[model samples]
Target: MVSDTLKAVMQKEGVVAIVAQGKAFPHVVNTWHSYVSVGNDSFIVPVGGMHGMEEALNHDNRVLVTVGSKEVEGLHGMGTGFLLSGHAKMISDGEEYALMKKNYPWARAIMNITILNAIQTV
Candidate 1:
Protein backbone atom coordinates (compact mmCIF):
# COMPACT_ATOMS: atom_id res chain seq x y z
CA MET A 1 0.00 0.00 0.00
CA VAL A 2 1.06 3.62 -0.56
CA SER A 3 1.52 6.03 2.33
CA ASP A 4 0.83 9.77 2.34
CA THR A 5 4.50 10.71 2.64
CA LEU A 6 5.47 8.27 -0.05
CA LYS A 7 2.84 9.73 -2.32
CA ALA A 8 4.34 13.14 -1.68
CA VAL A 9 7.73 11.80 -2.68
CA MET A 10 6.27 10.42 -5.89
CA GLN A 11 4.93 13.82 -6.80
CA LYS A 12 8.39 15.35 -6.64
CA GLU A 13 11.13 14.94 -9.20
CA GLY A 14 13.38 11.98 -8.43
CA VAL A 15 14.92 8.80 -9.72
CA VAL A 16 13.14 5.48 -9.66
CA ALA A 17 14.97 2.24 -10.32
CA ILE A 18 13.18 -0.88 -11.40
CA VAL A 19 15.20 -4.05 -10.80
CA ALA A 20 14.31 -7.29 -12.50
CA GLN A 21 15.81 -10.76 -12.75
CA GLY A 22 17.52 -12.03 -15.84
CA LYS A 23 19.13 -15.28 -16.90
CA ALA A 24 22.64 -14.11 -16.06
CA PHE A 25 22.59 -10.84 -14.21
CA PRO A 26 19.97 -8.69 -12.60
CA HIS A 27 18.61 -6.07 -14.98
CA VAL A 28 17.95 -2.54 -13.85
CA VAL A 29 16.03 0.25 -15.53
CA ASN A 30 15.51 3.86 -14.57
CA THR A 31 12.40 5.99 -14.67
CA TRP A 32 11.41 9.24 -13.04
CA HIS A 33 9.26 9.41 -9.92
CA SER A 34 6.81 11.58 -11.82
CA TYR A 35 6.26 8.76 -14.31
CA VAL A 36 4.64 6.56 -11.71
CA SER A 37 0.94 6.53 -10.96
CA VAL A 38 0.18 5.08 -7.54
CA GLY A 39 -2.88 3.25 -6.34
CA ASN A 40 -3.74 1.56 -3.06
CA ASP A 41 -1.85 -1.66 -3.83
CA SER A 42 -0.74 -1.06 -7.38
CA PHE A 43 1.39 1.21 -9.54
CA ILE A 44 1.01 1.84 -13.24
CA VAL A 45 3.94 2.96 -15.35
CA PRO A 46 3.64 4.38 -18.82
CA VAL A 47 6.46 2.53 -20.47
CA GLY A 48 8.12 4.68 -23.06
CA GLY A 49 10.79 2.06 -23.34
CA MET A 50 12.46 -0.61 -21.23
CA HIS A 51 14.51 -2.86 -23.49
CA GLY A 52 14.69 -6.10 -21.53
CA MET A 53 11.54 -5.85 -19.46
CA GLU A 54 9.42 -8.27 -21.40
CA GLU A 55 12.19 -10.83 -21.62
CA ALA A 56 12.91 -10.54 -17.93
CA LEU A 57 9.23 -10.73 -17.04
CA ASN A 58 8.96 -13.87 -19.08
CA HIS A 59 11.50 -15.47 -16.77
CA ASP A 60 10.15 -13.91 -13.59
CA ASN A 61 7.48 -11.31 -13.15
CA ARG A 62 8.70 -10.26 -9.72
CA VAL A 63 10.32 -6.83 -9.57
CA LEU A 64 12.00 -4.51 -7.08
CA VAL A 65 11.58 -0.76 -7.37
CA THR A 66 13.40 1.96 -5.47
CA VAL A 67 11.94 5.46 -5.46
CA GLY A 68 13.19 8.52 -3.65
CA SER A 69 13.00 12.27 -3.61
CA LYS A 70 15.39 14.68 -1.92
CA GLU A 71 12.77 17.39 -1.94
CA VAL A 72 10.46 15.50 0.38
CA GLU A 73 10.92 15.48 4.12
CA GLY A 74 12.24 12.23 5.48
CA LEU A 75 12.52 10.62 8.88
CA HIS A 76 15.85 12.29 9.53
CA GLY A 77 16.32 14.90 6.85
CA MET A 78 15.08 16.31 3.56
CA GLY A 79 15.12 13.04 1.60
CA THR A 80 12.62 10.19 1.63
CA GLY A 81 12.58 6.79 -0.08
CA PHE A 82 10.84 3.46 -0.33
CA LEU A 83 11.77 0.02 -1.59
CA LEU A 84 8.86 -1.68 -3.26
CA SER A 85 8.46 -5.34 -4.16
CA GLY A 86 5.86 -6.35 -6.70
CA HIS A 87 4.82 -8.48 -9.63
CA ALA A 88 4.89 -6.77 -13.01
CA LYS A 89 3.33 -7.31 -16.39
CA MET A 90 3.56 -5.42 -19.65
CA ILE A 91 0.39 -4.69 -21.56
CA SER A 92 0.10 -2.92 -24.87
CA ASP A 93 -3.65 -2.61 -25.00
CA GLY A 94 -6.26 -2.36 -22.30
CA GLU A 95 -7.99 0.20 -20.13
CA GLU A 96 -4.82 0.63 -18.13
CA TYR A 97 -2.71 1.13 -21.22
CA ALA A 98 -5.26 3.53 -22.62
CA LEU A 99 -5.17 5.55 -19.43
CA MET A 100 -1.39 5.64 -19.44
CA LYS A 101 -1.29 6.56 -23.12
CA LYS A 102 -3.46 9.54 -22.34
CA ASN A 103 -0.72 10.84 -20.07
CA TYR A 104 2.34 9.68 -22.02
CA PRO A 105 1.63 9.74 -25.70
CA TRP A 106 5.06 8.29 -26.37
CA ALA A 107 4.47 5.18 -24.29
CA ARG A 108 4.60 1.87 -26.13
CA ALA A 109 3.24 -0.20 -23.28
CA ILE A 110 2.13 -0.20 -19.68
CA MET A 111 3.82 -1.89 -16.80
CA ASN A 112 1.24 -2.68 -14.20
CA ILE A 113 2.84 -3.59 -10.91
CA THR A 114 0.92 -5.14 -8.09
CA ILE A 115 2.63 -4.38 -4.83
CA LEU A 116 3.54 -7.26 -2.56
CA ASN A 117 5.49 -5.26 -0.04
CA ALA A 118 6.58 -1.70 0.46
CA ILE A 119 9.22 -0.57 2.97
CA GLN A 120 10.25 2.93 3.89
CA THR A 121 13.97 3.21 4.45
CA VAL A 122 14.23 6.94 4.93
Candidate 2:
Protein backbone atom coordinates (compact mmCIF):
# COMPACT_ATOMS: atom_id res chain seq x y z
CA MET A 1 0.00 0.00 0.00
CA VAL A 2 1.05 3.62 -0.53
CA SER A 3 1.20 6.22 2.19
CA ASP A 4 -0.53 9.61 2.11
CA THR A 5 2.75 11.47 2.25
CA LEU A 6 4.07 9.62 -0.77
CA LYS A 7 0.89 10.37 -2.67
CA ALA A 8 1.16 14.05 -1.84
CA VAL A 9 4.71 14.18 -3.16
CA MET A 10 3.62 12.50 -6.36
CA GLN A 11 0.95 15.11 -7.04
CA LYS A 12 3.40 17.97 -6.96
CA GLU A 13 5.48 19.20 -9.86
CA GLY A 14 8.55 17.07 -10.51
CA VAL A 15 10.19 14.62 -12.85
CA VAL A 16 9.37 10.93 -12.79
CA ALA A 17 11.96 8.51 -14.04
CA ILE A 18 11.12 4.96 -14.92
CA VAL A 19 13.92 2.40 -15.24
CA ALA A 20 13.21 -0.68 -17.28
CA GLN A 21 15.30 -3.82 -17.53
CA GLY A 22 16.99 -3.89 -20.89
CA LYS A 23 18.95 -6.54 -22.71
CA ALA A 24 22.34 -4.82 -22.55
CA PHE A 25 21.77 -2.13 -19.97
CA PRO A 26 18.94 -0.59 -18.00
CA HIS A 27 16.79 1.70 -20.09
CA VAL A 28 15.49 4.83 -18.46
CA VAL A 29 12.64 7.12 -19.50
CA ASN A 30 11.26 10.35 -18.11
CA THR A 31 7.74 11.52 -17.60
CA TRP A 32 6.20 14.32 -15.57
CA HIS A 33 4.00 14.33 -12.48
CA SER A 34 1.20 15.82 -14.59
CA TYR A 35 1.20 12.78 -16.85
CA VAL A 36 0.32 10.32 -14.13
CA SER A 37 -2.91 9.19 -12.51
CA VAL A 38 -2.51 7.57 -9.11
CA GLY A 39 -4.52 4.79 -7.59
CA ASN A 40 -4.39 3.26 -4.14
CA ASP A 41 -1.24 1.29 -4.98
CA SER A 42 -0.72 1.89 -8.65
CA PHE A 43 -0.04 4.48 -11.35
CA ILE A 44 -1.33 4.99 -14.85
CA VAL A 45 1.13 6.74 -17.15
CA PRO A 46 0.33 7.93 -20.63
CA VAL A 47 2.78 6.58 -23.19
CA GLY A 48 3.82 8.80 -26.05
CA GLY A 49 7.18 7.80 -27.55
CA MET A 50 8.65 5.41 -25.04
CA HIS A 51 9.58 2.80 -27.60
CA GLY A 52 12.68 1.80 -25.71
CA MET A 53 10.70 1.32 -22.51
CA GLU A 54 8.09 -0.65 -24.36
CA GLU A 55 10.74 -2.89 -25.90
CA ALA A 56 12.36 -3.53 -22.56
CA LEU A 57 9.02 -4.43 -21.05
CA ASN A 58 8.63 -7.06 -23.71
CA HIS A 59 11.39 -8.99 -21.98
CA ASP A 60 10.80 -7.97 -18.36
CA ASN A 61 8.02 -5.88 -16.91
CA ARG A 62 9.69 -5.01 -13.65
CA VAL A 63 10.47 -1.29 -13.23
CA LEU A 64 11.94 1.16 -10.76
CA VAL A 65 10.10 4.49 -10.68
CA THR A 66 11.83 7.46 -9.10
CA VAL A 67 9.75 10.45 -8.10
CA GLY A 68 10.49 13.54 -6.04
CA SER A 69 8.99 16.78 -4.88
CA LYS A 70 10.66 19.86 -3.48
CA GLU A 71 7.38 21.00 -1.96
CA VAL A 72 7.19 18.09 0.45
CA GLU A 73 9.29 17.72 3.57
CA GLY A 74 11.82 14.95 3.75
CA LEU A 75 13.27 13.26 6.82
CA HIS A 76 15.94 15.94 7.16
CA GLY A 77 15.03 18.55 4.59
CA MET A 78 12.23 20.29 2.68
CA GLY A 79 12.38 17.94 -0.30
CA THR A 80 11.76 14.24 -0.69
CA GLY A 81 12.08 11.42 -3.19
CA PHE A 82 10.95 7.85 -3.45
CA LEU A 83 12.18 4.79 -5.23
CA LEU A 84 9.25 2.64 -6.24
CA SER A 85 9.55 -0.99 -7.22
CA GLY A 86 6.67 -2.16 -9.34
CA HIS A 87 5.44 -4.34 -12.14
CA ALA A 88 4.40 -2.62 -15.38
CA LYS A 89 2.51 -3.57 -18.50
CA MET A 90 1.58 -1.57 -21.57
CA ILE A 91 -2.10 -1.34 -22.21
CA SER A 92 -3.58 -0.18 -25.50
CA ASP A 93 -7.20 -0.75 -24.72
CA GLY A 94 -9.58 -0.76 -21.79
CA GLU A 95 -11.08 1.83 -19.44
CA GLU A 96 -7.73 3.04 -18.17
CA TYR A 97 -6.44 3.49 -21.70
CA ALA A 98 -9.55 5.44 -22.60
CA LEU A 99 -9.07 7.82 -19.70
CA MET A 100 -5.44 8.46 -20.57
CA LYS A 101 -6.19 8.96 -24.25
CA LYS A 102 -8.90 11.45 -23.43
CA ASN A 103 -6.44 13.57 -21.55
CA TYR A 104 -3.42 12.91 -23.76
CA PRO A 105 -4.59 12.79 -27.31
CA TRP A 106 -1.13 11.91 -28.59
CA ALA A 107 -0.78 8.88 -26.34
CA ARG A 108 -0.54 5.57 -28.14
CA ALA A 109 -0.75 3.40 -25.07
CA ILE A 110 -0.73 3.44 -21.28
CA MET A 111 1.82 2.04 -18.89
CA ASN A 112 0.01 0.48 -15.95
CA ILE A 113 2.18 0.05 -12.88
CA THR A 114 1.32 -1.92 -9.77
CA ILE A 115 3.48 -0.75 -6.90
CA LEU A 116 5.11 -3.41 -4.73
CA ASN A 117 7.37 -1.31 -2.55
CA ALA A 118 8.03 2.38 -1.98
CA ILE A 119 10.96 3.81 -0.03
CA GLN A 120 11.42 7.43 0.91
CA THR A 121 14.85 8.88 0.19
CA VAL A 122 16.33 12.31 0.33
Top model number, lDDT: 2
Listed per candidate, the RMSD to the true structure in angstroms reads: 1.1, 0.8
Which 10 consecutive residues of model 1 have the lowest summed lDDT?
A: 45-54
The sequence of per-residue lDDT tens digits that candidate 2 reaches over residues 34-90 is 899989999999999999999999989999999999899898889899999999999
The C-alpha lDDT values of all candidates are 0.89, 0.93
Q: 16-122, model 1: which lDDT tens digit per residue?
A: 89889987889898888788898998888888778687789889999999998888889999998999999999999988899889989999998988989989899
Worst 10 residues of 2 by lDDT: 1-10
Q: What would the TM-score be for candidate 1 when compared with the true structure?
A: 0.94
**True-vs-predicted CA distance for residue 109, candidate 2, Å:** 0.3
Superposing every Cα of model 1 onto the true structure, what RMSD results? 1.1
